[model samples]
Target: MTTTTENRHALPTGYQLQDYRLISIIGHGGFGITYLAKDTKLNHEVAIKEYFPNDLAIRENDHNVHPKSHQDKENFAWGLERFLQEGQTLATFQHPNIVRVLRYFEAHNTAYIVMEYEQGQSLSSAIKNKGTATEAFLLEIVSPLLEGLQAVHEAGLLHRDIKPDNIYLRDKDHSPVLLDFGAARYAIGSRSRSVTTIVTPGYTPFEQYQTKGDQGPWTDIYALGAVLYRIISDKIPVEAPKRVNAIKLREEADPLPPATKIGRKHYSERLLRNIDWALEIAEKDRPQTVSQWAEALLPPPSPTEQAKPVKPVNRITPATTSAATTRCGSTTAT
Candidate 1:
């Protein structure tokens, strides 16, 4: 799928950056432009990620990148360093579900990261075509995706952006490959300092839009829940901000029911409950680890296992809270 639309600002084809020749634009976003390029030296096609920073820089007629103004230069430089850091961090990831960034370099007054370009469609498009994803398909995609994400978190980095659109399903084995690093979003959000919002509406948790929201693995978990919700229901969840508003309102009606609630015939209760658990507006109410959430998606503990649990107690939610509206489970307006 075409990752981005509107030829807003992209380097023309044949443009050279080191040994890479720009073939075409693969994706474009506020912080960067991903291009399909040919590595003339290697004789291979690669995805070159350039630090475009649409909000901070622009392309001049001289074919070089420049900050929009003197004011943006500092922020632009900071974001550039972070982009390089993102490339360096991702270059070390050797997981199958993670996209590989082969190499990165600086040129044209900006940075570029060369990644292996997968010839496949994005999860978003796959969902659009299928209308609704099956439980088996959802598990097949999410479980391994979580493993990739676990690697990312262990590296001390966060992929603040984890929406369906950023997930590419490789054509070879239909395996999910995560695209886009959260470093860019964090950089942009840091620069704007509350003036600009750098988030996907439905996928971003309410706390994410806030610079001070207690973000962690759970933040990504919420977005993961939203993505699965979309895949199964084929509908966007209520945007985070609006959901927050409804929560505060208490009587304005919640947006949509949990996945199991809306997708009874389409999904199992265990799957839906886990999705709901991840989507708790409160960070304290969701799973704190991939393993914690994964357990919910699987069959509950066996009777003997429950009787003599070997694992440390992991509360799916605050114990004081019940599974009702006044408690943790009920998100009324269902």
Candidate 2:
């Protein structure tokens, strides 16, 4: 339940980032802060993400980014490059479910990526307002999300941070759009392995906490699975650190309780199993791809739908046939 929550450190309403005028603070997190701004030239709204790693850097009164100390210079520069790279990479994405990256630029002694201002509430807000959603409704939201994530994977990118708050349910038709790529998060991983930047307790997989944690498409898949679990159960999955400690203390016990046990009344067995598979403590046990995880959501054919089983009538076992032959040989005909 305890996840990282960022505070407001946005520029004043009239302040400008190039041609975009800052309107209000939209989102703030460990890695960066986003703002609702108007592109004066284009006359449209855009979300601008500023590369400000709160742990290592701070925004000065003059709106210039500076590291906390001389010690953080290398890490800050490295992260800024990674942030710019993320923008460049995200700009290439054209999927409807993936939030389009409008443009990226350097200013205020750091970098910023411009994005479309989506008119919708986050999945987290929607769930809080609507309570537990039905399985069908969950599938409708999860399917497009996985497809979009698959596109991200194909492009050799990993959405390291994926939580309910990061997914937006658009107003137009309730479409899901993924937000926030951990721009400065990657470099900070190796820069100082001891330090923690962003931690979305329940949604974040165990491997992500480690600096050398082996991650792949499965990493994002694990998060997506958690999102599905949260939507249907209306409960945050147990945090990874707590789960780890509990698991170690009781080797025989399941650290993360099965979703089926918690959401049996609301969800089908098949649906719960898929969620559990993704929440598996071991990475190898989880679905390696988004499609692999989503495939099991659909239940298999029921017994009635399958071919009917035929009962044996004239069939006999070896022993029974031998006894019948012996009786015939003894002339015990009836």
Candidate 3:
């Protein structure tokens, strides 16, 4: 994840450097390094995500070389295809709340994706900096996030990793933008026997931990619920309750702090109820689509409420102003 392009003969910095001027390092993760760079031709700042192709290729090679059986080789190939496919799939989505992928290419034996540079703190950082967000603020942030998820849902993409860390808040415009489509899976695709469980433990759905089953919108819904629960309670939900022999055991989950505790004083019961519904254990019991969950939290206005008549204000003219001025006796000489 090192951002230094100094030693990379394949990626030298200068007028001759590959189409971009590396400004500085931005962020780094296990997969690759992200650089805040300027597009030479476009003269716009962009985020350059350079994937560790060597690592991926090496990992693929290792899996092939040290396979326990012939089946292991097949599994390795499947995983490689999936990893590449994810990058291709993310390239297709174009939404305002979702980070835009400008370009995708390979250099120095590594694949790189150029994207919009989002200047903001992640949801995790906001929580850490502010301790806990107010209920209204949480709703403001989450509503837009859900809208972004809806776009992904419509595109047949399941964001397997939908956690606070992946939700960014842009300070410039005060809007939430979803990030990290690396773990996104296409709904309609060939099933590869690749068994890579890509998910964060507490934020991920229970079904994700299972070795088998098709992941879909419902799976993303579970993660969305987990994100909201954390924002509201400031406490991550405990792992899905486990069952014991002959009895279905469940642990007592922590209740959300009262609105009074946060000094909001008054709030809607329906909103809280919807939050709980989204966090339900059974996927079938939860809201099926992102839009459904969003609508539940943000219910439509009643017909009577919308039918209310509007009142017009009286107009103040120059004549009225002149009369008022005369009454005050503010004129000097003509």
Candidate 4:
């Protein structure tokens, strides 16, 4: 992404004086700031993400800075389009494991996406509070996580950013809810002059470090593998090797630390193999679909655990209910 200098005079908290009642500041990032707000009409809490505009008007009015006359409008347009598109894309997804976008609107020259307010800790916080999660716990978390991704992949979208921070654990249902579709993209076409990288470095795919070409399911697979690695090893995968001097999987990349080292039994060889496959240098060699990865990780049902068949019984008589029992008793001589 085009690195713009931080706007020192820009508003730190992104709440306007009008419609939204800002509860508290939740988070901030390079592109925008998130706030916990209550919608006056609905009287319910929601997350309102305010997008920062790249336009000169925003710079001069909001930040007390000025952009040169020749500054590219393309960046502004791209940001606006992505901000709106993410809302539209997320609004269509109806899965319980994904955050639901309630509304999208532009006001005061800033775009906002209102979404369900989650009252639970993020995966990042969970990891911090308790060290590395146990294997069973990790599986419990990642299984539903993969299921959520399966929904996203089926919708023909890519969540370019998949990290602990973006994964929320809802206390109400005790299920994982994937959030922040801001960096998401439709995988069908190539993005133009967007010389910007949209994902975090260590969690991103090796190919994403390159300046050209579109990313697909393999990009997300690489990120998910990195996340799993960290949960299991309590260490982030070494920064995706440099693009120009990127190391191939078989050559210089380090072998993943064994699960046994982390106080867990050695996982099946197939599981380890698939994890390694996801971290492969070439996207083609990795599992092409999220469901494929899920299949590799999910254990098969046991024969001994199968449900027993119920034997069929011959009918003795037709059963009936009657209000007029006296007349029925009189006719029961047979």
Question: Best candidate, TM-score-wise?
Answer: 1
Against the unseen true structure, what C-alpha lDDT does each candidate score?
0.77, 0.75, 0.57, 0.61
- Report the C-alpha displacement of residue 103, candidate 1, in angstroms: 0.7
Tens digits of per-residue lDDT, candidate 4, 138-242, equal 566676777678778878878878887777766554467888764523211124333243657567776775567457888888888877766666676666655
- The TM-score, computed over Cα atoms with residue i paired to residue i, of candidate 3 is 0.69
Where in model 2 is the C-alpha error above 4 Å? 1-8, 298-334
Write the number of the candidate with greater lDDT, choosing between 1 and 3: 1
- The segments of candidate 3 whose C-alpha lies over 4 angstroms from its true place after superposition are 1-17, 53-84, 184-197, 241-267, 301-334
The global Cα lDDT (0 to 1) of model 4 is 0.61
Per-residue lDDT of 262 in model 4: 44
Every candidate's CA RMSD: 8.3, 17.7, 13.8, 15.7
Clashing pairs in 1: none
User: What stretches of model 4 exceed 4 Å from their correct place?
Assistant: 1-19, 53-72, 184-197, 242-270, 301-334
Q: How many residue pairs clash in each candidate?
A: 0, 0, 0, 2
lDDT of model 1, residue 155: 86
Candidate 3's displacement at residue 321, Å, is: 37
lDDT of model 1, residue 19: 91
